[model samples]
Target: MVVSPERLAGAPHPLLEGLDAGRAAAPAAVVIFGASGDLTSRKLMPALQALMARQQLAPGTSIVGVGRSDLDHEDFRARMRRAVEQAGDVDERAWAELEGGFRYVSGGYDDGTTYKVLDEVVGDLDRERGTAGNRLHYLSTPPGVFADVVRRLGEVGLHRPALGGEFARVVIEKPFGRDLASAEALDAALHEVLDEDQLYRIDHYLGKETVQNVLALRFANSIFEPVWNRRYVDSVQITVAESEGVGHRAGFYEEAGALRDIVQNHLLQVLALTAMEPPVSMSPQGIRDEKVKALGAVDLLDAAEVSAEVVRARYRGGWVGGAEVPGYLDEDGVAPDSRTETYVAMRLRIDNWRWAGVPFYLRTGKRLPKRMTEVALQFSGVPHLPFAPTQAAELGPNALVLRIQPDEGITLRFGAKVPGQSFDVRSVSMDFSYGAAFLEEAPEAYERLLLDALHGDPTLFIRTDEVRQAWRIVQPLLDAWADDPAPPVDYDAGTWGPEEADRLLAADGRRWRRP
Candidate 1:
């Protein structure tokens, strides 16, 4: 009972098209490294199943899951089926129909011979199925093996132009690197084998519907873009927080913490889109160019300056939802005396003429009161107070909140007269909710990125320099925090963060937004 590709009479969503184009044009087969990992089962496979159920995959497209698991094609398909069923909303027929596309390759990442086998298997698929020599290489594996996999692919000529065909695109997952230097080194390693354009740096945040709506909201509407500058805007805040702790990722979280895990890539991408200038054209490069420029305009925080503006914290034992939880250090795989920061709050400045003097406060953390990701733009108060002192004081500055998750929507707040009040004013809000208004399931972030990678569109994905610029801004802060022997300030798990975080903004006569 799933929709077929043929039934998608109109243009498929832009995201789906991107995935299809990457597959169809190159006669490419998709090889997902780290095929047996949690990401593959929990996200990647589910996304592909959704694409297939929707009939968006290219004709003759083949998928080869690469992992060390000893599973044949049938076994792989069965595993993938369970994954699809568990992670997605699909009918049995959809699962049955999509199962035919599954395949597997088993080997250790360090073995070069694995790439040789991969080359052979891909060639066999092409010869038997009449698929053109195109391939989309997805590295869903750990960041450690990314360079090795890409290099091996190139060594075996798997990434080279096929017989009478073009090159394959390589897609990567998040936590690109540990820091700026490592990120740059990663770029260099990949560049040795793949051209810049052939790389898709996937940060799933950019794939969200609400995030994409940012572009449409700014460009499609005339009412807001004119005021999206320092002239009328007071400040902008981008936040990505989680209600859950590191959970199973404590090992990974020990090294990454919240900054690299979320801010450096996901949050920065949101900031870029929210602050980027309108591109001359909507082509991938044009849009990306504008974003890169915006990142370049981001002012780096000096050590002393960063210490003043930024605050990092560790979550301590506290009741969350009536259940007691241990502190971050007590999490499994975390060092007994680990100093990794689970929370980060920073006041940032963009040096460009458009956003100069605008204090953009960015923060993200785990084990907070609730899960919420949003971008709030606070506009300047009226130039003059035209009402009584009490009435005027009651009016808060206009705020445009773009709720990016949990409840995807846009809300505008303005002052209004309270009913039956003695000329008293109160803040009133008008909202556009995606769920209530559209009543449709928004495509998952991975679904959108998967489609875009298939379609060979790099616009929604981050470019190398964009990644570098983001790291550049945070590298200094990381260095300063490392140099300091002091541990991160501790906060109760259920609360927002440490008191210093409050004072980081309070000193400026401002406060962090509360839900």
Candidate 2:
């Protein structure tokens, strides 16, 4: 658990100084519950390997993968090696070091005997390696099995640390729930097995470097905060767009539409971060308190409001990336008459003093034009313009954009005079790209999140109250859509979204950004 002074002395960046400040986590066992899933292979395993490569993992750390698959330890290791290879470039030495600690335990979710076997396996690791009774359980399984796994952990006394021992924490992946009632039920079940501090509800989007930079951009700089309120800002648009269809996930998509899969968790979380008041400090609870407040202040929509403010649609067969793709109904495992929505756009208002009059527009979709997630703050135009109308016709309102993916960066757009004697102006962007500014590529989101969980830092992880608040805001819309007999409107696969999405913004005299 002790931080290596030698390692800290060789730190390459100021942001990594925390590594030398005795903040590095102690050796522990990270037991993943759904080890056979794609999430484990694609993200979790690769992240663990990268952390080892960076010497971020403790010397005696171990990973025990628990799943229903019949694979033994060696079989699991081989599969993971291939996964890590596919993820990125791999260092043989680092991969070998991480592989040495890999183990697998095959078992069913509801079998109490399986947990008993797991308890024994974890104890053996504590004795063989210097894990010191510290364990991190990752619930990467389906939501239906979340409660069963938590209860089994509690039943086997795996939710708590051994007497006078180190820590025990659990990391739960989303979707946390399908609706408000389910979310509340899950929260209640979690409380029975583990204390609030011992649980980490992970949303990988929050783990991104750019998303974290949002807080830094707002609080660290003085220029934006003063004018960030309703008085100077016109409207805010947050978009999480993807160009690919559901593909293999069509079965899950059939039951959980875009609303449940994306808007309820990721999109709402981004909105809270964008609109929250500055925290007293950046402590775990300090940041979460402000986020909860912001979410609580969200203007909940009623049935009437839902019809006016929300637009839901499905993607029809059309060319994407210059290739034709199947519509939602044509996807395998999807019902012929499925009503699930692949695209969603909604307008929200915060009922707080700081953002009273301003609107926040949020949208997310699958099978769209491109893969990009960003937050755009469009500033109100100048009240008076001294320039001639013809000279300023091309000028648009100033905007500050925080791009979260693809080209991760911040862009400030403003009017600038063209190269001529005449007073002509055009919109220009001043860009700050992450890749250009830093020499090292940012760590994967899973890497950051896993390290934080091991270090017992929940600042980046969502809290129980935050989850419930997000569900509360989206539940009415879910109900309204369910009660209506009409199916979701349709849009082409390669297009941005349904025409109704445009109308949703046009009604307020605004337009959706081409991005």
Candidate 3:
């Protein structure tokens, strides 16, 4: 059960100086429940391996994977090796060092006896190695099993702080609830065994480099913040589109449509980061407080208002990436008469003075033409246009785009004079590309969240209040969708979305960005 510091290797990165150079605080035992699942293989294990490769992990830190599979340590390590090779870019030396940190145990979610055994195993590791009683329990299992795992950990005394002054933290995966009431229920169940600070609600979006860089882009820059208010900005658009269909997740997608899956959590977080006032400090709670305030001020949609502003659609059979894909109903595990929405486009208005009159258009969908997630801050047009009518008619509005994925970067669009004898103005983009400028690859979202958990930093993780407020903001939309008698419009695959999405923005004389 014990891991030796001498067995570990590699020097740490400059960004991880504080965490890696600290007094090799008591080693940590990270217990990942549902360790045999796809998420664990694709994200969790690879993230942990990346951290260990960077030497950010504390000395003597060990990973204990808990699952229902009857595999030995070597078998578990082999499985994780495949996962790491697929998901991580570990050098040979680093891989050897990280491989030495792996361990495994067989356990079920509802079995308290299994937790008791786990507690004993962890204690033995802590004693043999010098990990000062610090433990992080990551529940990567489904929402249905979260409560059982937490309760079992509590019953086995692993949920509470150790008598020897050790700390305990629990990290839960997303899809907090179906709606406001269910979100509250989920909170109540966890609060039984965990205090507010001891809980880390994982929202991978918060961990992205570009997303975190937003704080610097806004708060650190005086130019942007001055005009970032409702005065200069016309409207904001948040779009997260995917070019792939629901492959094997149709069962989960059926119950949780576009609204719950994307809008409720991911879109809201993006909105908060975009709209929040500057925090006094970058502390976890300080940043979360501002986010909570921003989310709380969001204008909740009423049934009628929601119906008018919202557009939902299901993608019918069509071509995506030059190949044919089945419709939602035809997807595996999808019911024949499914009514779930695969796409959602809605316009939201903030009631605060700073953004009182401005609209924030949010949209997301699957099986689209391209995979792009971006936030566009559309600026107001010139009060008076001096250009000729012919030329003015061909130009679009100015926009500042913050691209989060596919190509993580920032682009600013403005009308510029063309280099010709004739006076001609055309829209030009000033782009700041992440890949071109920074040769090193940015850490995956999971890597950032896992390292933060190890260091007891919750700055990028979602707080309980933030989660509730997010659900509160979108509650009306949920109600409207449930009560609406009309069926969603159908959009073909490999397209932007339903025609209704275009019409939603056309009402304001604006259009979704074509990228």
Candidate 4:
């Protein structure tokens, strides 16, 4: 197992602590279902290359691309290499090491012939490359076909753990399902084919370094955890704002509006991470168990409360980041009368001892003011400010923000006395940047997650219960939106969300932090 100095630099994060943290991925057949898709070209290829560059993937491990495209192994490798090269400079030696094991099988996901062919290819790799029959199947295909892919693999006898305790695992991408019922059906289908332990439900947000650092900030450090509960924390804000419009994904965006697309997976996952109780240990199940519990504790809103608690809106044509963007309705392929929401803001109450009354405000929208993904905790104001009203008038509540992208870091806001001023106090932020703290830049989210998936570490991945619970929490809102006559409220692009969103906070005598 080779670990780049960049990853081993400084103190390792608490989440990264474990006996197997540095263990390389075992020799296995790494098969990707949608190997010709954009996710493969843009994300998966670069990530695999990075792992290869770091020598994290074991020598005998192989990648078998199973796609519908009619291309031989060499053509597939060339196409993927081009994408990896475009993403960044490739390590020629690592590329050579990885390229030899690359194979492609073109066939329909539902075709039994495809699985038989894939089985033969995998068997050959096991014998020739010493993969030892271990397999890691990544179902990168559309959610609609996930069950079929798994079932086909099962029919070909690829679902069972490989010989000699070598694992055979599958990774599935989300919108695990559109709603509660669909999610349950998908889970049942998957379970029928393979055990829960064999499936990895991936959400890239959980792979971010900052997102993982959240654990270190809470459980590893003593300062933050003490004030992390309802007694000291006033509110929690989780925002995943994107500056770009739907662009080429308007067709997909139309079907999975903000709630299903962002809220159900990314936002709720982050929320669970932020609010979850300290796990007894850093084991995969231990951490994921706490996350699932946190989501379960989120008070589900009734149909009646959905209207008041959740605000769904679409972005209208306007300037964003100084460039004009079209409205969601004007986006190509989007229906003119589409009620799909581009922005959603909701006030969630976690019904747990730790966060009983404290609100968790969640929001994610396309074409907002800027691209920012973060979780900010606003601590309650001081019990009593000793300074005169005029002295601390400008001071705001203390805040600890975990910035998940752009500039990945944490910022703690507090009040400070002004120098040479007469009894005046001002708010100040103390920042910790991942890039500055460590000499190396943090790996991209996909890179970290892909490495974890290959290593069979499911800590950063969503569990089955987590997915179903998230859908449960948001299902009422989904149904209410369907029954309502009015369309989603509209807000101009490049601005903050709709005015109604602001009022959502104002009604509680608080407001969202612009950051």
Candidate 5:
């Protein structure tokens, strides 16, 4: 069956619905630092290609790759071509169109001459390709060089837009800092070169179709909101688990651990979205303001509380996906005596009126039994059951689970009468899967975030205050963990996590959902 673009676009897909196909971005040049890095080939190039295929990119858009590699324009283009091909299938004409706009500048990040050359190259592209002097600089380099790249851009006048011209923006990758103080320092340095509006702190989680649908599932439907508060909700659990061990990120993971890498940014963002009040409007500031408020309401745990409420663990050698894998210490780049945590589970309380007494449980880890990310809200049981105790023994509290990955969907679990002469009730689920409900495939998270950066929409991107506030919420835990003399608890690679993780919820008279 031939499906029209209009039909496919307007279909009831969670991600594709309400997508504005006609919304055109202004002509701009994207300058990527460390363009030869894995992120560029694996994510950025493919995402840009996908955007081009959808006609979302403006005409005459250009891409400039900056790196220390000794590669000319054609070499970089060929490298990118292989990357895009590895990502997925590409139309020849689409590749050709994007290939035309590709350019390369080889230089060191610490050298001011590099930015000067970049300025000239960008200007030349502007004149030849009609890019209109608007630039979106992407710092795809390591955190150590982020400041250097930004300062160089400022020195070369690339951070400023042309007179009466379009805008200039920069997309910064995550791990904003090692801790609270460093995050503040990075923000200060960034503010010196660019205004807050010109900065886009990218957190890929916010761009997921399921993550964005969090807003729709709560606010768009009237029924869910009235009971969303602590009055009727029992608890909320957010889990991001990976079935595979850290393949080559051992060095990065050794320093970051699961808390700094995932919990501080991604899991916390999901928690805020799940608990935040409805925004006044859907504008970038409108949504972020509410998220900031929710994050600000999180109760900071003291050292004593941390010991009781938080669980940190490292993955020991065991089988995963039917294959035996080495432990974290066994990884190539990891230290044998490293105290880094591969898994973290914590119980949090939002001190706001909406969620005062309710607990928010969060957990994330690598080398788990499955790869899944979800937010589950368990509702309070009915106060008065009109049935016998035995008849309702199998019934459980109703839950609304929002599956963010794997099989993206929403599941509503409630009591359903078991078929018999008796009135016995059992838990049954009604699911809405993205694959089954929508014909259109969901766009990659990077594609959505990159397009937003080009269009100057900060809705999905983290703001300066949001970044600082997230750091603030996690600082106490980081401090406590740093001071503790005990090592992280150990769990087998293929297991869920440490036993302490289960005890975190067990202490509250509840348990985690296997999902």
Candidate 6:
């Protein structure tokens, strides 16, 4: 069901006309370090097959699974095949093209022999399967082992492409680091074994169709460009809410909390895409340069401002989706005295020529009422109104909402005149749904990210500067919470968040949207 832009037959894609749609994946051997893990089965495996179905993966491309699961080549192939079949439709010829070169290396990441065997397998693929001495290494292992694995590859001389015009890249999964110091440390560790251009720091949120559509909506359409500034916009609210609690990731959540888990990477990346100015070109560096600038423009809040503008809370036990769920402390593997925060809300300002005084409010949490991610910008109200106050009392300011998931659409909301002898106005929405507008369903986020990585495009991935600025912006909050051992305030699982979050908005006379 995944369709590439080039596969639109004789028609051109309106949104991707001038921008980089990226080329088909070149011939290379994709090496997954944690092939037996949940991420491999749930996302990576399906994504690779989806690319093959869409014919984006080149013919000489092969797959190599490296894990300690005690699975041989046949066993790994069977497991991956079942995963792909369950995901969606599969092209027989595409499977045949890749199945013969499937190889598995069973060993530990810290051991030396793992790389020795991996190097042999890759060499064989290059000579026998026409892989062209190119490689795409994916680090799906735990964060603790990321450095060791990459270093091992370097020791075995597998860090760079051996042939001319061949590409070699590494795709790193997120939760990049705990804070600013750790993020810099990780960057230093990676640079020792790989160049900046060879590393892909992927954040799946950036790969979403709606997220990428932000560029086309703002740059391709002239209606949005002139008004997308502080002069016309009052405030921007971005939300990433979840209805379910952390069911299986309690151990990781206890260490990361909401700040590192969501804010540092996912939410901040989305913020950059929404707030950034138009790039000079759609090339990888051009887009990345603007994103880094947008994030760099954010004013780092001081400790006093941190306490006043940010709200962090934990979820207490309550009914969710008609079922009762336990509180965060009651969850398995969580400490009874844990000070970890499950929800966070903060109001931020970008100090620059375009967004000098406008506030960008961002919040993310689990165990909320419903699952949703969106960016809503409300325009300033008219200075004067001719109608009576009562007639327009129900009308609200115009808003443009970009729904990233669930509904997966764009909504333009404005006041519409009521059909009656007496004039009245109420807000109505003009919606654009991807399903209703296109004949093909959009690809999964991982699918697009994987293809981009294979094609050596880092536009949708995070840059080092962007990551550093994100950590710098959140470091003050980290220090404040570290100095105090006080537990975060608690709210019911089914509620939006604590009343304290509302006060954060109330201070500015703005409120969180119900959506």
Candidate 6, after superposition: displacement of residue 210 in Å?
0.2
**Tens-digit lDDT string for candidate 1 (1-515):** 34456655665534233223323233457899988889988998888777766766754667898877888888888888788778857656556655556678888876888888888888887776544787888998889999989888888898875785555889999878889889989999999999998999899888888998898788656699999999999999888889899899988898898888988998899999999998765678878899999999998888888789899999999978788999998888889889899999998899998999999999999999899999999999888767898875667879999999888899999999877758888788999999999967887888878877777778789899899999998898899989999999999999988999999888888888896
Q: lDDT for each of the candidates? A: 0.84, 0.90, 0.83, 0.88, 0.89, 0.89
Clashes of 1: 8
Among all windows of 10 consecutive residues in model 4, the one with the lowest summed lDDT is 13-22
Model 5 weakest lDDT span, ten residues long: 13-22
How far off is residue 195 in model 6, in Å?
A: 1.0
lDDT tens string, model 2, 272-387?
99999998667788789999999999999999999899999999999899999999899999998788999999999999999998999999999998999999999999999889
Model 4 segments beyond 4 Å from truth?
Answer: 1-16, 161-165
Clashing pairs in 2: 1-26
Error of 5 at 283 (Å): 0.5
| lDDT string, candidate 3, 469-509, tens digits | 99987788788877876667899988989888899889888
**Cα shift from native, residue 218, model 4 (Å):** 0.1
lDDT of 6 by residue, 1-515 (tens): 34465665655544354334445777899999999988998899888887887788888788999988899999999998988888776668878877888899999998999999999999989988888889999999888888999999999988988665387789999978888999899999999999999999989998899998888789767799899999999999999999989899998899999999999988888899889999876677878899999999999998888888899999999989999999999999999999999999999999999999999999999999999999999999988877898888789889999999888889999999988987888889999998899887788889988988887778888888888999998999999999877889999999999999999999899889998
Model 5: per-residue lDDT, tens digit, 378-488? 999888999999999999889999999989999999999999899999899999999999999888999988998888888888998888889988898899999987889
276-372 in candidate 4: lDDT tens per residue? Answer: 9998777888898999899999999999999899999999999987787888888999997899999999999999899999999999999999999
Better of 1 and 5 by lDDT: 5
Count backbone clashes in candidate 3. Answer: 2
| lDDT comparing candidate 3 with the true structure | 0.83
Q: Over the full model, what C-alpha lDDT does candidate 4 score relative to the true structure?
A: 0.88
Error of 5 at 288 (Å): 0.3
Identify the superior model by TM-score, candidate 1 or candidate 2.
2
Q: Looking at candidate 3, what is the lDDT of residue 342?
A: 92
The reply for model 5, stretches above 4 Å from the true place, is 1-22
TM-score of candidate 1 relative to the true fold: 0.93
